[model samples]
Target: MASRRIPKAAGCSPIRAVLAGPAENVITEKLILKPAPETKTEVVQKNTSVHNDNWFELMAINHLSEKLQAATGVKSMKSGYESLVEATAMVSKIYNPKRQQELVIQCLDSAIPKIILNMIKTLLPQTQFTREYFAAFTTVFFTWLIGPSEVRESEFNGRREKNVVHVKKCRFLEQSNCVGMCINLCKMPSQAFIKDTLGMPVNMVPNFEDMSCEMIFGQEPPASNDDPALKQPCYKSCRAIQKHTAKCSS
Candidate 1:
């Protein structure tokens, strides 16, 4: 996969304020409102060009797929992103929303050994450094899923912090096309894993308008009822409505 390098701290850009957290904040959330979903979700699939994934990226994808298989107790013959998505679909089918999220977290816990998580939690104490470091880390390492991204600055506590990752276009979102999958499968689980495992909260703000997103490290996510992302309707081409369909609004 083609990836962009995170620029140095001096090169960080302070863009317009567009983010919200659990607490009241100066920045506001920028979300493109969509029509409310029907009881059924429409899952869509698009034929996109294949990515030239490197060995490391392939290894990461394979490891994650294995972890998901182990968690869901279902084996997949597909490889790369397909296998992971298949496993995720199984997870959505086999459990409630809460349990699905928990199972994904458990998969993450298995994918990443507890020793590393403990070391990170012990060394990084939810400070500005930890947040920025994670932002940069995500930029470098998460390209296999999120596609190319860059580290940007966001206003936090009246100061600019380079703790935001601006995804140019999310590979997962574009591939799945279903907003429900983006939320239940990727967004919610990711936020929970980072906060619970790393001891640093992150709010993943995905812009359905263009499939771009922002990962605001150190910002606590809003409740489900208050989160606009959860309410977003599936794309017109959503195919999940036929396969692995669940409560899209939930």
Candidate 2:
């Protein structure tokens, strides 16, 4: 009881004690506790980096679409699908499949640059011409130019290869609905582009049943006589087949 008088309330609050200390130290401590401005900046930069190519992608698509239109003689972009098929049929009527392939190659050759070819050449050795590299390139480049496709990797011939690009529903095929057009226009030219131009062998297999197709990269194509793609019958929905009332053969 003698000292029962409670110790006077702490002479100063803890905050006051801190405030009473060196102003510079207090300011430094506050700054240390506060979040850095760069933290917010870094988050913004990361998001922007991922989305940096909007204009570039748009430009690329526009350029490719224009080239396709020019090559196919399709004046209107609105009717690109129909025009592409019509143009293919016209070409098929005028030229043999082999010649059609050469024309398509010439068109593509002009559009894609020597620099890109050189880059591919440089990277091909580094990548060992693996299926994954080619598949990735196809997805990023070809799909953007054409339509959607999926890359499926599997073991073949005693090696793992991401060699297949599965087009679940091809825009060209759906619009054309003709087996001959698929072979002459898309399949043959694509094979030639990949194999002869890009130096990667590929065989394009079109399945008309579901309007799906598989582009098998890194594989040699069979002879036309032995190829099932050559043997495919015209789709029931083919306009030519319907109009002519005739079956299509290789």
Candidate 3:
């Protein structure tokens, strides 16, 4: 004899889904409010045996609602199975060991497709700041990192604009697309840092001859600025790099 079922009205939580994340989602937490070394009541000396263990601080970044945070950087896909075809094609191009090796030495703008790099940024922040075996997680986590502006705008056929949903949590102004805008530019840890450490252990790195693809997401029309002189240069850079970097998707 078994019970029928649990009612939908009682207790159900999305926490597990949020925490047991996927390639497309990243979970971040706030840490700005913590006391600095001077303000703290406890002091642990680096080489002293008498120092106390530090407490684990597991704070959470407020979850960006999926719609509010769908990826803005990927190109719109063709209908039906072609979307799968297009995506698979992109993966085949990117996953080459050659590209990965090139990526180790190259900037996000010069090495990889902007969408691929952007998707990586979207998921890793939620990876709990743990270890550096990120390429393993990139396959699964990259897809779940959603962007709100992306989804709403998707419905409008490039005509309908969605009102922003603004929520402030920690230092992240949660609703602004600016967060996504800054994803690669702001969140990137330099390849130099990565290579320096990885070289100590796994020293082998690959080489890419010539890998070129336009960035579909970040490449947009140059944003208008007040100073005419400054405006022209920015417009030129944005336009010139259209051969590779996505102009606008963040």
CA RMSD per model (angstroms): 23.8, 16.1, 28.9
Put down candidate 3 lDDT per residue, 1-250, tens digits, no spaces: 2334434555773332223446567668787787555411112111112212122211111111111112212232443222322332232233342332333234323334667655555554422121223432322332222111111111123443321111112111111112222222212222232323322111111011111111111112132233121222122223212433333322
Candidate 2 structure quality by residue, lDDT tens digits, 29-69: 34346665654323422332111235555576556555655
lDDT of 3 at 39: 19
Top model number, TM-score: 1
Q: Give the candidate order by descending lDDT.
A: 1, 2, 3
The lDDT values for all models are 0.82, 0.63, 0.25
Q: How many clashes in candidate 3?
A: 33
Report how far off residue 86 is in candidate 1 (Å).
1.6
TM-score of 3: 0.16
Off by over 4 Å in 3: 1-106, 109-150, 154-221, 224-250
Q: Which pairs clash in model 2?
A: none
User: TM-score for every candidate vs. truth?
Assistant: 0.78, 0.64, 0.16
